[model samples]
Target: MAEAGLRFGIQLPVQSQSTIYCEHWETEAGPAELAQAAQAADRLGYAYVACCDHVAIPRRLAGAMGATWYDPVSTLGWLAALTTRTRLLSHVAVAPLRHPLLSAKQYATLDLLSGGRLLLGVGAGHVPEEFEALGVDFHRRGAILDETVQALATALTDEYPEHPGPRFPFSGLAVSPRPVQRPRPPIWVGGSSPAAVRRAARLGEGWLSQGDRVGDLSAQLRLIADVREQSGRSGPFAVNAIPPALYVGEPGWDTGRHALTGKPERLAEALSAYGALGVTHLQLRPRSRSLAEYLEQLEAVATDVLPLVRS
Candidate 1:
């Protein structure tokens, strides 16, 4: 059964062109198409619209990951100006690559400007070469990410934040334009590893799973619950899932066997299963051949699929 109030959001296309998921049509699409999709999400009552981050891609991995990765902070800032209601998300900003204060300065300004709508999804980055290029220790990324999250919590909440960490330490420094969200915007930890799950439980306001299978998520959820309970943390924590590639109604083209296709009710039933797994937020990727078809998919999700899921 679908959990009551299971919220959904889309990963805005044309921002990252990873060969793993990017449609052929997205190759020809650009900013105007991106804006239109975001605006539609805003108008249609999606909870958030998310963008991915990558400082730069090496030629070695460029064939698969692509080279069109947009800076999440800049893209989200632009989306903030374009939409009024929908929250802005980084999907997973690699925080360890940059100092927490620098991130805090940029994100705090974004939250203030966006009227308190920011979900800072952070991850310990995977690409070692990118880390090397930026002078961040690739092997120590997990530890660095842990400290970075702690520092970000303090920096986002306090104008004059202090951190005694070894790698990035500072005190008595003030960052102006405090965030609109009280005490700071929500930080969502992203990744599916054991350490990442624990990090999300201990520090994040939410957990953004990196495409973990539905069958695998229950164990992870149990792990999160155990960690939070042991740590004596008490508050609402958002649990997220990314469902199979979605295409509302029957697709005239191949959507692959992994995709959830057909009528609104069928799609709703499958999606609502995430809610049953204790997932509170869903990241949806709609398959399309062109910009018009993409918009149509979004519309179908909002008008037909969401209502059934909600009910």
Candidate 2:
């Protein structure tokens, strides 16, 4: 049902260990494991390898959202050196947490160092405490994110970019080592809220859904289309989805009832449904017990499932 072939990518583990998605093995893993995962993604022809971002985690939420979030800029910058072709993605950096210029400087250098393989995924962060700590108003994060996205577009595109705004206003200052991507690297807005989707349509090159149910995607896509039409924006806009955790074949251990498990053909048939819903790319998390098992699953996806996805 896909209008075109669907692309696949992975959100690198051992970085951010949220109770909702983190596998048991990731807790014991470290940088070596992270590098291997990125390397495998690169060798296996994945579209990108994603990293999460969080400046700090309040103790109240630390138990659930562990404080293990590796800085996306630092982590992705390191992974960039290890992988050859896989694009580096900040799964949703809370850009409003810092000044737009600082964000621009960090990402611009990353794009330059990575030879232009950067996907700047931005989001309005959820934690109120984090905003307070950073001197950013939690309630105004959405508006700040909008302005930040616009500022980033200009900053990444021009060495002496200027933008006058209520939140961030600057001119005449120059940032060196501009992003290698012409007109700037793709900015993918993340979140499933109505405001988030509208921002993506208006400002972003793509939309990164935050675990929206498959049943909800059609409505979201329609909303994106409506907003884009209203805004008179037209161009290539990627639609991304994070499907349920996947396992290529029958799992030896319990992968839970929600996981998509079975033979490659069955898995492909299930995954291809997202394409029918207008998802251009998928961010997959494979269910596994260890790094070895994780790599095996990635191999299975690349070899057994990927070939049959479009067929």
Candidate 3:
């Protein structure tokens, strides 16, 4: 929970340019712009900065996905040095793409170096060609991911962790510079598929749901609750939601019909409904054509919007 209202984060622009959500300015932006955005998020009190992961974008998806994915570990680790307080998240790293030890080492170093501000959000992944390119079985990725999650749970926390699994087994190998967080960073499983929800309830600290329609969230929440209850998970768990593009203040021009546009007060009232549904965190992606406009939106949220809505 944030000091004021619900905790919020942004999938920082200029990192990943997925056709579905990539912004206009990102195509031309670089580290200078990314750092500026991250630093502003930290200074303005955003909860965390998140980045997406993809080893490669196959030619088929290249047109829509622009083939520009900054490695999450490297991006977040870089931002970790630039900002002091904001948390770091991988949004949804495809864990089945790499061995758990490699992932653990990279993330453990990041967490330890950054004073334990890493939240490892992972997914089973969907890109078949990328899996093929990496020599991982696309059909078995889900099972592979399940095992990897168990392997990470051990590797991230123990100095000499042992994981005897179907693949990637180890008994005596020790990893240096363990994560600063005692049990390692919190893992928020991504995706809203049946397997994803179940994996989150059974293994993760939270669920970063994949854009379940607003009308359907109640059913999904109930399902999560049922699974947690069945799995004996009595501890706290975060349920996340990502709303469509938002234009905080009235744009007079044409912000789309789905865009949430209004005075700060109106936005607050509308957003408060999310809290009623038990959403612990909300990831906001403001509509912007330039870095300056984006930063202005962040400032507006920090000064005007957060106060009225944060609980």
Q: Clashing residue pairs in candidate 1, if any?
A: none
Q: Give the least accurate 10-residue stretch of model 1, judged by summed lDDT.
A: 1-10
The runs of at least 3 residues in candidate 2 whose Cα sits more than 4 Å from the true structure, single-residue gaps closed, are 1-4
Write candidate 2's Cα lDDT for 1-311 as tens digits.
12256899999989999988899999999999999999999999999999998989999999999989999999999999998899999999999998999999999999999999999999999999999998999999999999999999989988998999877899999988889999899899999999999999899989999988889999999999988899988878898899999999889899988899999999999888988889999999999999999999999999999889977
Which window of 10 residues has the lowest lDDT sum in candidate 2?
1-10
Candidate 3's residue-wise lDDT over 109-162, tens digit each? 999989999989999999999999999999998899889988998998788999
- lDDT for each candidate structure: 0.92, 0.92, 0.86
Which residues of candidate 3, in runs, are more than 4 Å off?
A: 1-5
Candidate 1 per-residue lDDT, tens place, 196-310, comes to: 9999999888999999998899999999999999999878889878999899988988998899999999999999888888899999989999999999999998999989998
True lDDT of residue 177, candidate 2: 85
RMSD per candidate (Å) reads 1.7, 1.4, 1.9
